[model samples]
Target: MTQILNGARKCFVQRGFHASSISEISAAAGVSIANIYQYFPSKEALIIALIELDLQRHRSLISRFWSTDFSPKAIEELLADIFLTPEGHAVAVLRAEIASEGARNPHVAELLRDSETGLIGSVHSLIRAAQRRGQISNELDPDLITERLSLVFEGLMRLYLFSPANGQKLIEQYYRQFADTLRLRP
Candidate 1:
């Protein structure tokens, strides 16, 4: 099952959701199409599974933040690692493919919506915790803050995708400016 998901993710990232065929995924997975179908009824099902897997990974990443001091520097570091690293670039590519599919497919759009909702909820909780710790301004509304932060992340991803060469520097500068706004004022 993991192999199938990994294969599907690779094929989708390389060839896009529509261009990738079951045969290609089967070859990538070292499994027969019959085996893949036994686990995932259709390509859409594979997409859902991949999204679910990404959600789980995101949840785990959020939990790590929960355990930390919730400092602006910590947040900046996390964001940099996610958006500026080589592994992160691959993940970002996959995310772009998923987002493109979402634009054309209602079901994929719904899944993406659900994933974003879950992410927002997690980030909202993180914001609330930071407020309690006096690391973030209590004047900020957690929900609104979470939404805007999500937008910032999406923008960062887009920027990185568009300009990989300058992504790290741009992300650092943007995040520093954004983090300054979030920090509790002396």
Candidate 2:
């Protein structure tokens, strides 16, 4: 069942939630459609499952990465490392899918919200840490600061999503700007 779910995620990432047929998913999973349906009742169910899996993975990443030891600059490097992987490529696809399919699929939209909640929390924690460590002013709104950083990160991802030719320069720009904005007092 787990294997099937992983395969289904690949199919959805590659062909998208709307266009990917059960047969394609089954073939991608190396299983029959009947067997696939035995676990997931419908294509919608499979998509939900995939999104749920990805959301959990995102949460796990945040949990693991959340630490006082690693600075935001270091975290950005870690992010770049993970996002450059083949499986990491799914992040871009998932982001694109959420933007395109959110209206048609409430599940996807909810998953996106769930993801954003975790992301925002992670950023909030980071900012709070900076304040505690005297890295940044304590008067700032952690939510707003993190939201702006997230916006920059997402904007960079958006640029990279449609045009790989534009490359990591834009992503690096985001990292530099975010780090600069979050830097400690002199």
Candidate 3:
């Protein structure tokens, strides 16, 4: 079962959910069709499992992002890394493909929604922390702020992930300037 799942994730990342088939997954796993079925009843089931695993990892990253456990420069570095690094590119590629499939697949939609909710919750927690510390205006709603910020960050990331070489300087600038406009701190 583990072998099948590992292979399925790789195949899906390479070919996407819509294009990958059970036979290909089986071959990648070095398992037979019957063996694959012993764990997942269908390919959709396997995809869902993979999404869950990815979301768990993403949640960990989100928690770290909101902790403010580092200096301001560190945060800027983090954003730059997300947009300019090789690891970031691979993650973006897989996420872009899976998210595209999610647009047409109900199972994928569920996982995506759940993942976004958790991510937004983490961002909201950070906003609340800032507000409590008198860093942000008390009237600012954390929920709304987190949502808008998440959208902005994701949009910025999408732009840079596609053009890493030319995108790094612009992306780094945005991260540096973001605190000025988005902080909302008195």
Winner on lDDT (1 vs 2)? 1
Q: Which of the predicted structures, 1 or 2, would earn the higher TM-score when compared with the native?
A: 1
Report the C-alpha lDDT of model 3 over 1-186, residue by residue, as the tens digit: 779887887787678787989999989999998999989998778877877777776677667666653345666566555666766666666677767778989878877987787777777877678678776677877776666656666676566656767556655555555564455332
Candidate whose lDDT is highest = 1
For residues 1-186, could you state the per-residue lDDT of candidate 2 as single tens digits? Answer: 987887787888888877888888888889998999899888878777776776676667655554534465566566664455555567777767857776777777887877788778776887787688876779878877776766776787787777654545664676576566666332
| TM-score for all models, in order of appearance | 0.85, 0.81, 0.76
Give the residue spans of candidate 3 off by over 4 A: 1-3, 30-32, 134-139, 170-174, 184-186
TM-score of model number 1: 0.85
Deviating ranges (above 4 Å) for candidate 2: 63-73, 118-122, 165-167, 184-186
lDDT score, candidate 1, position 5: 89
Number of backbone clashes in candidate 1: 0
lDDT of 2: 0.71
Model 2 residue 99 CA deviation (Å) reads 2.9
Among all candidates shown, the one with the greatest TM-score: 1
Candidate 3 vs. true structure, TM-score: 0.76
Q: What would the per-residue lDDT of candidate 1 be over residues 1-186, giving only the tens digit for each residue?
A: 999988988888788888999999999999999999999999889988887787687677767755665455675677676766776776778778878878888987988788778777777888788788877778988877666656776777777776777766766765665565576342
Local lDDT at 62 for model 2: 54
